[model samples]
Target chain A: MNYISASPALLPARAGVGFKPEHFGAIAADQQPLGFFEVHAENYMGAGGVPHAQLRFLRERYALSLHGVGLSIGSPEPLDRDHLARLRRLCALYQPESFSEHLAWSSHGGVYFNDLLPLPYTEETLAVVAAHVDETQTALGRRILIENPATYVRFSQSDIPETEFLTELTQRTGCGLLLDLNNVFVSARNHGESALGYLASFPLIAVGEIHLAGFFDASEAGAPLLIDSHGAQVADEVISLFEWTIEQAGPLPTLIEWDNDVPDWPLLLAEAMKAQDRLRHAERGYARRLDRRAL
Target chain B: MTSVMSGVAGDFAAALRDPLVTPPAMLSAHAAPAASTRFCVYRNNVAVSLIGALEARFPATRRLVGDEFFRAMARLYIKAQPPRSPLMMRYGDELPGFIARFEPAAEIVYLADIARLEAARTRAYHAADAEPLELSSLAALDPENFARLRLAPHPSLEIVESAFPIVTIWASCTGEAPLTAVEDWRCETALVARPRLEVEVRRAPPGAAAFLEALARGMSFGEAADSAAARAKDFDLALIIASLIGGGLLVPADGVKQMETIHGYLA
Candidate 1:
């Protein structure tokens, strides 16, 4: 399927937030419209309940994105058909505008670790990830946005840079990218690399959505290491990096994620509102650039 | 090719679960195995997140045992048996059984039952939605044929019977009741179901679980009532049925299935 043109129309180039059940009342009653709301697909995988009821209500109001956290897309083992089938069923039920999963695996040796475990970025690993993406896209009959992972370790066998690996996967599977700017900042800081340099090399045009979130500070062997905790407010550094990304990518569908210590609606909304301010600035800049080109 | 990839992935997986296992030789930071502490990030994430999933599902159990004790217990459980699938909402399905056999938890006789009750609530919350069987349908049934009617159990209904006062313990710890000593040591039965948006965990009298179980097995009302009466000498059929209706614990029939002759209906 031609994923880019598929409707309820692509997610608007505005700010969005990850859906938290606690914020359902506020989100449903709010007067201001959001660009979209992203939900972890696995949370609503059960047959029926309030999760679905709430999602259904939200679907009627705003664009929806089904984010898959358990596809285990980087596994060497065959793709889990049962999981793919569940995703298909969910898509049929909700008809979400977008679907995305991580560029990491969670299951191995017949066990799901429940963490987005990192993998080697080599040709062998690349083939495995590409095949998984192919199977998912074919199974769901829609292009998926594969998010760059927040990693603490890199493989010695990985000859490919993270950007090139992601770009190749998009090329092979016709998948789009979901650039998580906070993840970029986290991974870069952890690995002693420049976040700006990583984004400079990244294939920005293929990015369909963006994520910004908070990280906890930690260290390894007395060197600074950051954990993608997603349990707190977006860091000032991450927000700055996000602003830079919008300056280049020009107001994509950005999301504010606070999954763990999720604040009250007002606090979370303020985070999205902050991203919206930056996105609105980028939107106007793009408009002015268009007028200049016409002149 | 697949086996080699699996071997590589297996080593990575093993290291994440076991702090003892050496970090995989192929993994590093700045191109050296010196980043084993960095490797601990993935390890820590897996352990903390899985334990967090369990704690969320078993809040009452966590409360009965303080947060520290529960987490330490959960960590041991995770190490012994990590989740086999990614359907994490119900990941700790075997936790109750594990706690039952666990040596440390042996003295807390009711801890395992609390886990089971909490697990049942998780199931009830996610179970398929259904409407309550209307009272009018029961009222309209022919007197002779009513006893022969087979009611479908609501998908979310779960009956947990225990020798310990699990209902009181759960209610007290989960904010429905203030913490109080349970002076009366006795058996308890909890009817856990989400007939509507909210999951209701109600205490039931003796023989209620058996009655509901019999009904759930597709037995006729007469048979279920007989089973309940046999189990509990003082079983009141009216009271149990009233509780069932009040909780919307049975799926509403299709406008009440048309009944045949009395003998035919019983058959």
Candidate 2:
């Protein structure tokens, strides 16, 4: 059905904040125009409610994106057809500008773990993920963006790097990349890899969205390990990486996430305004480059 | 190959049931027992995530027991009752029943009801949205015929009866009401509803509770009022009716009437 296009026409590069229920009144009454708003798909999976109503209101004023965290794309068990159908229904109802999931699994056997869990980068896991992606696209009737996960530990038996694994998934299934830069910074720090190199390795041509969020330094045994808690301010280093991403891939629809100890709407909107500043600069840079090429 | 994959899937499933012991090392392709470690990670994530979901849905229950105690009980709960849905707000529907039979905290006989209140609050939060009936709609009706008329509760209303002063406990713990010196806390009933998007929980009169319960069971307004009056010296029909309507507990009967008279209309 192609509910979401691979080359979808995104809003002119700008920043948005996650749509939290607490800030709904402020966002509704405020005069600021955000580029869009992103929400955890599971939060709105209810048949109807305040969250649904709030999302319906916000959707009219701004572009909406549905980000899912518990699809368990790497599970060996068959995809939950009911969950897929619910996602399909939500897509039909909301018609979000973009839809995305993680490159990790959360459930196994039959039980669901709400957190995004890491998977081994191997042919078997790859095959499982590709099949799930195919099934999800078919069920959702649209292509999806798969976000790379932040990990605290790495499997000793991993055959492929995270970038290669994500690239392979995109190639085989024609999926797009959400390219969470803060995750790149977090996972890189946790595993002692260069964040810049990791960002450079991303297949940016397929990049559809960018997520910038805070991280917690939960180093175990004095060794630096970052937890993607999304609790605080976006680090300056990650913003630099975001800037580099803008230079490399041009500005995509970026999102600022603050899921824990959520601040007031103005605070979140201010953070989004920070990304909007960067996106505007990137947009002007791209325009100038295009003008120069014409000359 | 299909049979082999299914066997492997079954083995992995069994491993999840008891993941403490060392699993077979060949599950990972690079051969360092990464699958076991990954499985351990998955187990930890599931335990923590589901436990957190429960804690969020059952804060009053958590407060009744301390955080540490709640976490311990929740771990036991995760082992016994895994979530069936990814929509986490719906995860702990069976928890009240589970707490009733749970051995560790069974001494707190009222713990199950407290858990029921918490679960009801969670359900109310996620309940379907509806435009409430205006006060004038009832005002337009003849007072004589009001007793025969049925009032449909809003989609988000839930009533619970507890043997402990659960309303006091919840209010004190959530800081909704100022704390007072402890006395002999009496048994109480609770009414939960979401007139707006947020769910509200508060104590209810026994009469009102009984009335709402009957109405919830599809009783006519006259019968439910009679039931309410049986429980109290003065079940003020005006107060209860106004309260229910004001709290968005009552919906107009148009939809139900339309459904009931469908055959006649078709004829």
Candidate 3:
């Protein structure tokens, strides 16, 4: 049975925020002018109760995006068919406007680590990720987006760059990219790479959505190490990068993700407004470019 | 995948579990002065996230044990038993047993039972939804057939019996009573069920646990009453049945074709 009201065909190319339980009552009481709200798909896999109830209410009112964290799409082991089936069932129930998962692995050898563990970008890894994405898209009967992961260490034996790996996956499986700008910044800083340089090589045309979140900065032996903690507000550097990304890509569905230490509703809404402002700025810039071309 | 890549993944996992094990040597040392310090980031993430899951699942237990004790204990448990499933909601099922065997927590004898109750509540919150059988649904049944009536328990129904007053302790953690104020400590049975949207945890009356447990195992109503009566001399069958119906603990048994028809009609 259809669980949500008829929603738009795609999430509006505007600003959204990660859905947290604390804000459920507030969001329900007053509909914020949000583009959409995103939730971790695993949180709603439960058979019944508040999570589903709140999700149903939100799905009826606003556009919804089901972003998954536990798909383990980059694992060496065969895809977990049971987990995939559950995800398929959820997608059928909600029919979310967008479904996305990370380009990282969480489960290996049947043990699931809670963190999004990084993987080496290699030909073998690419083949595995592409096949998994293909399987996921086929099972769900919709194209999925794969987000880049924040990494701490790189593999010495890896041959392919992160952008190349994502591009190859998109080409092979026809999947889109969920460009997490914060993760790009975090991984670049953590690995001593230039964030802008990474963005220059990134296949922005394939980006279907954008994620901006906060990171924690710690020094390991005096070198800056950025962790994707998602505990605080989006950093200035990340926001600047987001603006540049929107300038390049001409506005996509952007999300402000504050999963840990979630703020009060007004604070969260303000963050979304920031993203919305950037999106509108991009729109205006794109309009001016078109006007120039016409001139 | 290449053996080298697989080996690196395996070693990385091992190092995360055990801090003493050095990070896999294949890690490219581009950013940090020491790869080990960088590797600690993943280790910290795994520990903190798993601990957070446990904390959410067993808030009362964590409160009773204090934050430092809980975190240290949770870290040990994480090392010994990581989650086998990607579902975070179902991550801490093994925690109660681990706490039971944990040496440091031996002083708090009732802690494990409290954890069990919390876990049961978590499970009930996520269990499948079902429309409960109303008390009036049984009106059409003949008095003679009442003895043979087989009742089904709700999908979320869970009975947790403990030697310590786990219900009072759990309730105390929620501010119903202070922990030190629990003077009369006695064995308690908790009936956790999600009759509707909100999961309710109530103290089951004397002998009610036995009655529900028997019925949950497919015993006839008369047989379950007898079992409960045998366990507690004060077992009042009528009162227990009313409580069960009120709490939405009992459903129409699938084995009874007539009951299914009746349930359909009620629906």
For residues B1-267, write the lDDT of model 3, one tens digit per residue.
567557867888888878888898888768455677788889989888899899999999998999999999998888888998888999889899999999999999999999999999999897766777888878887866877988877878898999999999999996756667678878999999898888889888878988877887889998988888998988987778778887788877773344334322110
Off by over 4 Å in 2: A1-11, A220-222, A264-266, B1-19, B22-48, B182-185, B207-210, B213-219, B223-239, B254-267
* Highest DockQ scorer: 3
Candidates arranged by TM-score, highest first: 1, 3, 2
Best by TM-score: 1
* lDDT comparison, 1 vs 2, better candidate: 1
Chain B only, TM-score of each candidate: 0.89, 0.84, 0.89
Q: What would the per-residue lDDT of candidate 2 be over residues B1-267, giving only the tens digit for each residue?
A: 243334444554455545565644445422232445535644565566688788888887898788999998888787788776687878999999989998888887788988998898878776666566667777867766777776777777788887788888778777887777547678888888886766888667547877877777777788889987998885788788667876677775554344334312111
> Model 1 clash pairs?
none
Which pairs in model 3 have colliding backbones?
none
Runs off by more than 4 Å, candidate 1 = A1-9, A220-222, B31-33, B253-267
Clashes per prediction?
0, 0, 0
Per-prediction DockQ, in order?
0.43, 0.31, 0.48
Tens-place lDDT per residue, model 1, B1-267, is 565466668999989888899988877787432578778878888888899899999999998889998999999899888898778987999999999998987888999999999999999888777777866767877866878877766778888889999999999999998888988778888889988889889888667878878877778878888988999877987787778875688764432232111112110
- Give residue A34's lDDT in candidate 2 (0 to 100): 81
In candidate 2, residue B244 scores what lDDT? 81
Model 3 chain B lowest lDDT segment of ten: B258-267
Quote the lDDT for B75 in model 2. 81
User: Is 1 or 3 the stronger prediction by lDDT?
Assistant: 3
Q: How far is candidate 3 from the true structure (C-alpha RMSD, Å)?
A: 4.4
